[model samples]
Target: MQSQSVPRRWLSLLAVPLFLAACGTPESPPPEDAVVRVVTPYTVRSLDPIKQGLWSPEWGYGELLMRATDDGRVEPWLLESLEPESPTSWQLRLRPNIRFANGNPLTAAGLAAVVDRHLAENARVGESLPGADVQVLDDRTLRLTTARPVANLPHLLADEQGISVFDAAATEPSGDIYTGPFRVRSLSAEELVLERNPNYWGGEVRLDEARIRFVPDPQARVLAVRSGEADIALYPPTEALAQFTNGSGPSVAVAAQPLQHLRAIPNLRKAPMNDLAARQAFALGVDYRQLAEDVLGVPYRAPDGLFPDVVDYALPTQRTDAAEAARVLDAAGWAPGPDGIRQRDGVRLAVTVLTYGSQPDTRTVAVAIQSQLRPLGMEVTIASVDDNYAAMRDPAGWDVGLSFDGTLGYTYDPIGPLRSFLTSGAQRNFGGVADPELDTLVAEMEATPDEAARRPLLERAQQIIAANRYVVIVAQRSSPAIVAETFAGYLPSSVLHHISAQT
Candidate 1:
């Protein structure tokens, strides 16, 4: 579904001040009958699904067994149904007469072979679905057994690991294959071109050819769409939303599903921030609303808690109170020094916040946060790092880190991500949290299969996270795109399949 048209005030993030042409004038016509050209901020890391397809959506050459609808429902696309047969096993039934673009029939044996390939090489995928051994029952039926009883097995299978089912006999397991509406025509550093597959299982694709260009800079992407160099632009700069909404450019749209959140991760293992009181003060100090409305200049719903309300079992919203924040800092024995920064026993309340330059908004948020913490006597230094993850992993490299996290499992499930954050000893538990009670709750949530039973546990975990302030969630991200007026039949969902050609 298309998001509501952004108001004029909110479109300030997309405003381009120096451009003469707005939306009214059509730019140069399509190049020699070009179907559609898409410009995205993401660079093509790899065409192989196992390599980069799990995260990047650039390669849409293959299809998944099931896909999540815009409303986050898991519906069968390639597979008819995947039912649990035993505690550790599931029965998969393929849709009848499904065929790859190359005219290879999708059989149960071929899927089993693909599963084996993942198990042998892609350990991360294998770990995501532990002991995922597939057994073919017939041409249309297969049985899948996991090492452990993964409650969200179907969700786990919704990613690249479970989505693309290649026929082993027709092609090698690792090379590029076509199952979706489009087949890969050519791929280079600058662009990727696709040709419509006549034998695709999902019926005739609308577009004759789909071309995607990798333009990392947000401004360049917007300019491309505005100039008719591209039909659609992905991840436009939040500061340039005005350029799209002023009714002089391509139509701006936001896909709000599978929400991503930007958060502040305090190193719990450190000294000043190690104290719960300091952490609470840190959490309460930042004004998320100001950052959203003022700094971002875009329409953003300031997250009340960690996860947005759309996420299952998400807690109620919370806002910052400056008075309470000061009280909390005072209670923790921090006093305003001569420099107007907080100090206690010779130690200053100075912390460096590390973020990457790739996402321009992160730096803006960091600067805004640095300004917001001044009244609270917190000295925040904004550090724009080249490798954000490496800096986050290093104790000496950063004190507080800014990052956007994706949810666990394949779809919108939070259990996997929660486990990484809350569970003790989890590799991704970067905050150095060691709460036994929270760990127990995460374990319970992971073990429990029924969503009914899992709700309370998830609720309790959210409460614990709120109280501890492990990660200060700033805002939930709604990934936006601006498509040209000529780009018709655009697929509007979380799963962004290739666009169809305009009639």
Candidate 2:
């Protein structure tokens, strides 16, 4: 299940000219009631909820039926209550008085329409909710039906990428189509302007507007905050934390344990990596401690497994031994060549590591991997692409890929990452992992309702992933942000988009 290539126009957003323009402008002093300026590495190329990815919810321009707490517990947000009526059925009651940005009331029919649109537009939705059907019980209540008993239905609905409630009547992408804290005032490749939704159902929004600017370069984001050109700079370089913590300028707020974990995925479908010993060598060759402490800086640590420590079912910390890695390569007949790189059957133990610019730290981590693996007689080539997913779909383009994998924050459970990346024929499985055991475990976990009952299955699934060395878990990152003094008390969340100013 390969992902489609990103539109050329969308990739054009990362052009050198646009990056220069973003860094060229100097922000003017804002009035007492001015828009809050936010500089981040992400950009929203499309206003369509289906194509927006996480930007719609992150910008507060759209809302989901359910939301997750800071600790990753799923709770009703747009819905007043969600209870399982049966194994395959659930009753959803929307919160009363909820309205879109255009002031139109949110009814069960409207919600149904949004669901239907998603099912029609996205194949993943239909695959996720097989034999899906929705019935509008009344103005506020709806009954969701599925062919299979989805134990984590609530978590699925809570996923912003899965289903977002928007005004189906609206013909185009605009603020009116969404029911969130903010409305899309204006959007471009470089910037997005969101105005507060006056008819917000939850409570009064303190800020009048939010101006989000896209700065792909981590250093540029840091400079933007230091120069007072941005109110909040998201994902600033970890090495630059010293400047923010000096107490002379803006302050830095780091998440306790961010759900984002940097992973190095090897192309199991390609040469050298196709061998289990090669994959194991690659994993053991990496210095997880140095990557977490020296390279990633404070708050970041070597991951226990595929997930962060915050996840209850995460496996024990993976082992790292360069000597063992070398021994494994030697035992596998990969002898060191004249240039010190291992070679066997005339094929060098060379790998192309792919990373994207969106999460700037991925490139840094890739470079570190290149350096660490060199001493182990592995030739690591780094290819920093604009779009990693698209590039990764073609295994010939790269051997190993460095990127962030979100567990609780993105999917509210470890099941999502497992099913998406490790299961047979799963989407985003660029590493080409296909294990019957892992697939069976994931299916059982999905069928099992209680979290307590599912813990063992989750643990076993992680063990399988680790044993196979499907992905080299580098380190868990701490969500770092530099904030202006005016927004001094701003704290970054493990959930990337759950942001707010401390007024």
- Collision pairs in model 2: none
Across 447-484, the per-residue lDDT of candidate 1 in tens digits comes to 67778888898888888888888888886666677778
Cα lDDT tens digits for candidate 2, 74-127: 788899999888778889899989988888888888788778777866666787
Report model 2's TM-score to 2 decimal places.
0.84
Which predicted model would earn the best TM-score? 1
lDDT of 1 at 245: 74
Report the number of the highest-lDDT candidate.
Answer: 2
Q: How many steric clashes does model 2 contain?
A: 0
Off by over 4 Å in 2: 1-35, 45-47, 169-173, 185-191, 214-220, 238-242, 326-348, 356-360, 383-386, 407-409, 498-503
| True-vs-predicted CA distance for residue 105, candidate 2, Å | 2.0
What's the TM-score of every candidate structure?
A: 0.87, 0.84
| Runs in model 1 lying further than 4 Å from the true structure | 1-34, 45-49, 52-59, 161-163, 173-176, 408-410, 488-503
RMSD of each: 9.9, 6.2
Worst 10 residues of 1 by lDDT: 1-10
